[model samples]
Structures are given as structure tokens and as C-alpha cells.
Target: MPELDAEKLKENALTSIRLGIEDFQRSKLEKDQGGDPARALSAVRNLFAGILLLFKYKIAVSVDATGDASVLIFNPPEVLPQADGKGGIEWKPVGKFKRTTIDVATIKKRFEGFGIDVDWPTIDKLQECRNHLEHLHPANTLGEVADFVAELFPVLREFILTQLNEQPADLLDTAWPVMLAHHEFFRDTIAECQASWAAAGVPEMMQPWLESCQCEECGSSLLRPSQQDIEEGASVDNQDNTFKYVCVACGHSDLIAPLMIKELNDAYYDDPRDGGEADVEECNECKRSTFLISEQHCLWCGAELDYPTCTFCEEPLRQEDQFNGGLCGYHLHAYEKAMRDD
Candidate 1:
């Protein structure tokens, strides 16, 4: 049997005992407040038991009373064999004694090896809670502590299993039920946050910014009223005629005016033609409304005009060669000459 390093063993026993007492006190408070005090008590008892086991394995042990209860301490046993012909018992001070601190970076690296993205923010939050638990007097209530543990245990257990190369199901026999309850609480909190944000009217910048915008759901912009039309105080011509702007994206629709249909159409298909430019053509049949272009056939009887003719020059004009400003080039020159003679 290897002799234990007395100082190191003593420190380990002391630290575990202190932690156990703290857990015991916390458990008592929780029990007083209708919490599962048994679990907390059990954790503390396990801590002590683990310490006693180290003592049985030839680690150092001692006792002290600092707070309200006596503390049992156990140090780590050394495993190296003796150099002399003496029995395999050797004691050599390894290093300075210090409380066992969790190697966070090491644990994180191990978790990464298992392909789990470590949620740093959550880890930070849990660490903050742990610090609060250790330092704060009249420590957090049972509900608060349990809530913290509930949030932390899943992540911790995951990390532990990954490090140990154990299947999660195998570890779940010890940690699953608590984790499920904790996850439920986590989900509820997230839902509440989402609802609160929604109720607060969190602006959706992605929504289209047109007054006559189509209903996100239906893709029909027919019922939407233009901002200009609405400002003009126009009413729908038929009250019974219901129209809706249907959204193509979300299938949402909004009831709007028939006027909105025209406005949206105009807005969507704006004519690129300049506002002041007037296209003029002459009609061979009547010669009236000479300033009007036969957009489709003849303006008089709707007969398809062969093509536009010059009103002043009385010459047939090709579609592309039609006169601008109501006169062909020759007639424009003649008009200028007549004006000069006058």
C-alpha cells in the first residue's frame, strides 16, 4: 500500500467537509421553504461519504469545528512505491496544498471534442450564480438555487459524460429527471420573453413599406388603399364590394378600397413617359381632335387607322416617324415662315 501525502490529504478532507456543511445548511433552508430538502441533504451526505472513502483508502483525515457543525477532513493518498527494500509505502510532499478548482478550459476543450458547442454566455451566468451562492449571506432561496442548478446541471452533465467517454443515457440514470424539469422551466422562460417582446410591438423592419402593399399572405394588392387616396378621404364606391391586399409571403390579407387597386397598379407600373410631352396625330376621316393620337385604331369610330398622319402637313407618318409637339418638320417650318411673313 502506498503511503499518503499527509498535508495534501488533510487539505482535501478539510475542503470537502466545508463544502458539505455549506450544502447541508442550504438544504435546511430549502426544506424550511417547502422545497426538496432531501436532494440537497443527499448531495451534502454524498460529499462527506466521498471524503470518508478517501480516508479508507489511506488518505489523511482530521476533524475541526468552525461554524455550527464539526468538519471531517481527508487528504489524497500518494501512489508511488518506495525506493528502499521497505514495503511499498512512501510519502513525499508533492506541492503546496490548494483547494481543487475545476479546470474550466480543460472541460470546455473536452466538451468540444464531443462536438457540443459550449454556450459561453450560459456558462458565465451559471458561474455567476455559483459565486453568489458561495459569497452571499442569507444565500439564495431554495427555488432560486434549484433554478440555477437546473440550468447548470444539463451543461455540466453533458461535459462530464463527454470527458468520461460515457453514453448520455448511461449518465442519465443519475441526472436526467432533474434535467428534464429544468429544461421545461428554461423553455417557459424563453416563451414568456418572446410573448413579451411581441406584445411590446417589436417593430418588424422586414415588412414592406408601401401603403398599398399586398397582403403578406394572399399576394393580392387589390384591396389596399394608397396613402395618397386615404389622405384624400376617398371612400370605396361600393360598400358591399370587399377587396383585400393579400401578402404573397405570409398569406396575410388586409381589407382595402377599390381605389387602392388602381393606385397600386399605377404605382407598380408607372409610365416612364414625360408628364408634359404630348404625342399628337391627325385623323384622315374627320380631322377633329387632331391633337389626339390614335392609341388604338381611330379615335372617331374605333376603326384601326392605317397609321398616324401629320395634321399640318397632311402627310402619312410612320409609327416611329410621328410628329412631336403636334406638327411634322415641314409643317413646323411652314408655320414659322407664315409667322415671319405676318
Candidate 2:
């Protein structure tokens, strides 16, 4: 077995960490003016590499009985201990060549064994985004890049400070301030946007989509309902029904109804042609596929629908089952049977 120096591995880990932070800082600084996509991509890739390297460093430093350092290497060769002639033992590798280093999965399992409280979901998210950006060009947006950093900051900060016994601010240096500033800005913006949505007085059914709403044109989620839109939404009987929201990021105006219809329908329904029950259906009055059966209202035309009954048998109908010639599914089936018999 080749003698591996623990100090060299540690140095490599530290270098990767510093370079990762520097890349991340560059990405954050250029975020406002539609920053370079390459910076964000590099930031994620370097940070992921740094994290894996740190994990490997931790594993490499752990002491073993034979001092063979086989545990640090993936698919490590079995070693046989023999007498070294002078009341000593020597361990030899089973294979002729050195094995590859442990991978991310192994690192995670080993961390769990060592009782490390790392937030692995955050790590996985970073890895996923990194792969997406590096392999698939322009896969993630700047907002997504900021989101990845914001979610990962606390995990990285905790691990570096508690596990590595190092001051993050000192290690990260210039990147530390940039990370903190970006996190605060990202958090406050989300809070403000959510607050504005809450005050918009959208219906209870539409609240979930409001939080995740994005501008279709620019894909920016920084949309806010106008004051007039809020007032109309609050009013119980506002016939005007013209609610508007503007994407602050893109300066684009869109009607809230169409956006809500698209989002809500996508969230709740699928094509009936695909053999799935459609949660939303076409509105009889508006001829638009914006009818929410649960709400019993056309989201686009404001047409309130009553629970449908079969015209022939007067039986209650399932909300999702479309009425065929004013007949429930049971009656429709019976009519079909009778026609076939005749």
C-alpha cells in the first residue's frame, strides 16, 4: 500500500473550500444585473466539490488499528497482517494498485456513523442544481441560484464552524459578507412578496399558488397585486372582476384570473384523455377550462355551478364525471346498454 499523507488531503480540502467561496461570492455580486450564468454554474460545481473533499478529509484523518488508511479508499483491498521479524506487524494491500477515493454516498453513510448532524437534503439540492447547470445549458435561473445558496448557507456555515472548528467568516473572507447580504436580501424579498399576496385577499383556494406564482414572460416570481386589484378581490360583489398583478422584476402586467387558472388547474388537474380524473373542467358559460369543481365556480367567468343531477334518473353525479347528454354515468351506461340491446 502506498503511504498517504493526511496533511496533503487536508490542504486540498481547504483550497477547494476557499476557491468555492470565491466563486459563490462572484455569482452573488453579479446577480442584480442579470449576472453571468457561468459564475453561478461554477459556484455550484466548486462548492459541491469542496463539500465532498471536506467529507473525505474528515474520513481520511480518522485513525485505524493497522494504520493502512484503507477505509478512506473506495473498494479498499483486504490487507493481511504479518510479523515484521522484530516483534512488529506490517499490513499489506491485497491489490497491486491504489483504489479510488470514497464517493458522496459513502461520505453520507460515514457521517451518519460519526453522528454528524449535516443537513443532507441541502447538500443533495446543491448537487442536483450543479449537475443540471453543468450538463444542461441554462437549466436554472439566477433566482434558482440565489435559492440554492440561501438554502445551503446555514448548512455550510454550521458544518464549517462546528465540525471543522473554523470561523466561517475568516475562511470565507470576502465571500462571507456577500453570502450574508444575499441571504438577508433573498429572505426579506420572499417575506415581503408573501405579505403582499396575503393582503391581496385572494380566495382561500388560490392562496397556495399565490406564494409560488411566477411571471410567464420572464419567469420571475416577484409579482405583486395592485391596490385596485386588492380592493376588488376584497369586495364580495365586485362585478368589474378586473384584478391585475404586476411582476416587479419584469414590469409586466397580467390578469390574476388567468394566472390563477393556469397555476391552479395545473396543480389540481390532468387531461381526462390520459384516463385521470380532471379536477377542473370546461366552464359551460365561458367555454374555458377554468371550472374548479371543488369551488363550484368558473375561475375565469365567475359562473357558479350547482351540483349536477341526471336529467333522466335525477341521480347525483360525481363532480369529476362529465354529464353526457344531461345523464349521470350510471344512466348513461344504462342508456347505452338499452340501445345495444334494441
Candidate 3:
């Protein structure tokens, strides 16, 4: 008799997204520390659930009966007769999301009809990853293919904004502390991955090394042998096996012996019940990655620890150690260089 409540569902949708972010941040920490990638799969499952809630919201606010019909299919119409025996039977609605054949296929087609451009190929791949995470033993390869999660955030956020006509900043504010922190982590993680690929310089030769090695500095499994014949930006200092590796996540390049590298790999992948946070300090501001207390700041978010003097951001150095310049490994060095050059 009464109409569906859109406001309440929207509130729930936002909350789900926040919860999903929390799960993802925690699991990501585990993966970065050379722990089991399987731990991160649970985060994927939870995030997908949050995404499904948004789909429900989209369907709930349809422009016409087409929307109701779409929902009606899932919420099957139950045949109910009037009080009088002679009265004809009328259709009663079932629960939400009960319509016939409700799935990725149905949702995609419906979104397309509304001129919403959802990325089907990426979504398709993610679904497969999610299935494996849910049903089979989690693999490092499975984690590798999950790059789509970072790509999907903007798209889904846009869908909610465009359909609901809500302001981005307002949704952002609603998302709050976690939203900003997650955004930073997602952005930095992707950038770190990209930099590693670029730094790989000799990919063809290093493929085997990458396949066998893991980068403890970045907790990345994409470690591979570096191209030894690079230009003499500087002469090799202690060139032994030339078996150095570059981590896509941390950009740490070292000329370690092959046997030493293998030992490091074992140490990195060793399973831990507490995600290896026992020795590392979680960021005080963002609470993302766990770093050594000696660092005095989180390597991921630049959040100060100990004294909390928090000068990391106030003085954004154009260069800090190997990092481009910024705090906690965050940097805008390239942009600053361009400004100076101009």
C-alpha cells in the first residue's frame, strides 16, 4: 500500500560502502607485508556486496513501470483472490530482488537502457575472481587479476551521483575519514604498481625472476630480475649476480644475491595469524599499512607516530630519500619539477 522508502536504502548503501572499505584496507595491509593473498579475498567479497546494494538502489528508483516491472520479475507476483469466491485473482508482490533471472547480465542490460555505461568486461573479470575467491583456494595469480577493484570505484561513485543527483562532495563527506583514506591508498597502490612496470626496463629477461620472487619492501609478488645492461646512470657498486629486483609497490631496487632473494621470498610469504602487524605500527591518521615504530611515521599515509609533531605534510620535500618527495612515500615531485622547468 505504501511506496518504497528510497532515503533509508540510500543510507544503508553508503554504510555498506564504508564497511567494505574497512575490510579492504585491512586485507590490503596483509598482502603488502608478503602475507597470504588469500586474506584479501574476503575483502573482495564484502566490497562486491556493497556494490550489489547500489544496484538495488538503482532499481528501486526507476523512472516508470519498467523499473517496477524489472523489480516485479525478481519479486514474483503471488496470485491472491478477493474475499469472495467469485472474485478474480490478483497479483501480489514478493520480496525485493526476487525477480526472475536477476544477475549481472540483467543488471548490465538495465543500466545500459538508462544510458549508464557500466564497464562489463572489467566487471566480468572481477566476478570470475570473486567466484574463485569464494569457492577455490586463493592463488597469487588470482590476486594479480583483481586490479579491476581500483578501476571500478570512480565508475560506481559516478553511477550513484548521476542517478541520485547527489553532490560528490556531499557523498564524500558522508563517507568521511575512511573514504579519503581508502582513496589515497587505492591511488598510491596503483601508482606504485605502474612505476614498477616502467622500472622493469628488461622485462623479457627478468620474467623468470619476477615469477619466482616477492618484494618485501612493497609486499608485491611482481618482483623480477632487473635489466643489467642499463645506461650508466651510475656504475654498479657491488655487482655480484646482478640479481637485483624492483618492487612495483615500494620502488626498492637492490642487488641482492639470487639465493638471498629466494630466502627473502620465503620470509615474505610466511603465513602469520595476525597479518604480521605484531612488529609494525599501523598508521595513526589513516590506519592503513603497518610500519616499524622506528620509522616514526606510516610509510603509506605519512601519518606521524610517537610525538605526533606531524611535520610530514607541512614540508613537502621535492625529494626524500628514493621517494619523489612528500610524506610517507607520497610524492608530487614530477609536477613540481615541471613547475620549476617552466
Candidate 2 local Cα displacement, residue 172, angstroms: 2.9
**By TM-score: ranked, best first:** 2, 3, 1
Best by lDDT: 2
* Superior candidate under lDDT, 1 versus 2: 2
lDDT of 3 by residue, 1-342 (tens): 224555555677677766655555554555566555454566677666666656756766665554464452253445554454566655554444542434677677677776766667767766776775566444443333234356456666676677767765677454445555545666776556445445434223223333444444433444434555244322222243354656554456775344343443343443477555333433445443333344455433455533322135543221123243233333355566668999
List model 1 lDDT by residue over 67-149, tens digit each. Answer: 11111122223345455556556656454333342234433443354354555676666555555444433322333344454
Using TM-score as the measure, name the better of candidate 2 and candidate 3: 2
Q: Which sections of candidate 2 miss by over 4 Å?
A: 1-14, 25-37, 61-102, 135-140, 214-223, 226-332, 335-342
Span of 10 residues, lowest total lDDT, candidate 1: 66-75
Q: What is the lDDT of candidate 2?
A: 0.67
How many residue pairs clash (N, CA or C atoms closer than 3 angstroms) in each of the candidate models, in the order given? 18, 0, 8
| TM-score, cand. 2 vs. native | 0.63
In candidate 3, stretches whose alpha carbon ends up further than 4 angstroms from where it belongs are: 1-5, 28-39, 64-101, 135-149, 172-180, 185-200, 203-342
